[model samples]
Target: MVVLATKCYVEGDARSRALDGMGSMLDDDLGELSVEWTVGVRDDDFVSVTVEGEDATVARNLLRERWGEIPTDGRLTAGETYTGTLESWDDEGFVLDAGTRVRVPTSELGLGPGSPSQIRDRFGLVQHLPLRFVAGDADEPARLADAERDRLYEWSRGAGRVNVNSATRGEVRATVNRAGHAGDIVTVERLGLLEQSIVCAEGTDPPGLLASIGGYLPAELKCVIP
Candidate 1:
């Protein structure tokens, strides 16, 4: 069994569509392998896969490489590294869906001194971005990983881009293409189970691109400026 690090946080028909899409993606990912697998969606924003057959181990590793290993409860001891889908945030802190919800308080955000919202905006950290954090113990709150910090800083240095949340990679790509600005993006970087970062083409402003394509996607879109 392997728990994948993506979230399906929509509801009703949207929820069904998201689940079906995720199941299809898993099948496609493992289609060529000699393994039989079934996927289950967890309430806590994870996709669990149970694989059988002689090639199960290989399938497990392949899935692990594609989606970072889900941090099991036993691994949450203080100072251990884990990956999670960024859930939501407020003045207090940000919540990560690490199979279970893990809170990273404002003080432990590691993105410098500011309100959580301001820090997120300043750094372009969108919802559902796969964030790495160290598990905390007792009264301590989990803190963002140094590498994750470095990565956000790198994005801040690059050309500005448009970020989208609550949609899968394919959905975001299709929306972008339908917006008639297909030539305006460099690439669509998958940030989580549903979040995507559309890197802008040269001389393309993120805000303009967002304005152009925002109407087509049923997702929260934000502009990240360098």
Candidate 2:
């Protein structure tokens, strides 16, 4: 399953209200699945968001197609999509694609309204951590740490910096925690945050390690990756 986080901005009172109403438009297009809605007020402006299911690609496509139809107080602006990969799963629901990360919604898939867990699981996240930054030195430990922390999973000799096509924020976070490093150092990569990478970590055994950390981190300490 894929999770997508999309935001939009609009102008005008009527348009703002219309934009708020537009959150439900996806339900009409994607059927009656559970969605979580949040509205934010910034001075005279308003921002509204609808978090749907774990299928980010589908949700992104739907939002891209329907954003214009929403009415708003001001001009409507579409926000970027934050995509998460599936990491693990059980009888409840699937974890995010990033790694041992679990996302248990209130409603079941293809069912009613959904609820998101406040804590994100960290399994399978280590391999996805960035190994280098685009402009930073390749050998410096700080630079290397930044790269790894930023979700750059793959690096080419001549291409400078390349993102790990399969890496996800969740996976990298879990991996960092498992390595006994500060997981908070890992952050979402700007470019691939919305798309999945084709590159994957070299090993297969690490996934189990990530899952174990996911179960342990939430209880051991405030393992937050900000």
lDDT against the true structure, each candidate: 0.81, 0.31
lDDT of 1 by residue, 3-118 (tens): 88776777788777777776787788878888898877776757788999888998899888777778665357788788887788989989987777788999888788889888
Regions more than 4 Å wrong, model 1: 71-75
User: For residues 193-215, what per-residue lDDT tens digits would candidate 2 score against the true structure?
Assistant: 21122222333223333344445
* Model 1 root mean square deviation, Cα atoms: 2.3
Cand. 2 Cα-lDDT? 0.31
C-alpha TM-score for every candidate: 0.87, 0.20
Which model scores highest in lDDT?
A: 1
RMSD (Å) per prediction: 2.3, 19.4
Give me the displacement of residue 192 in model 2, in angstroms.
Answer: 10
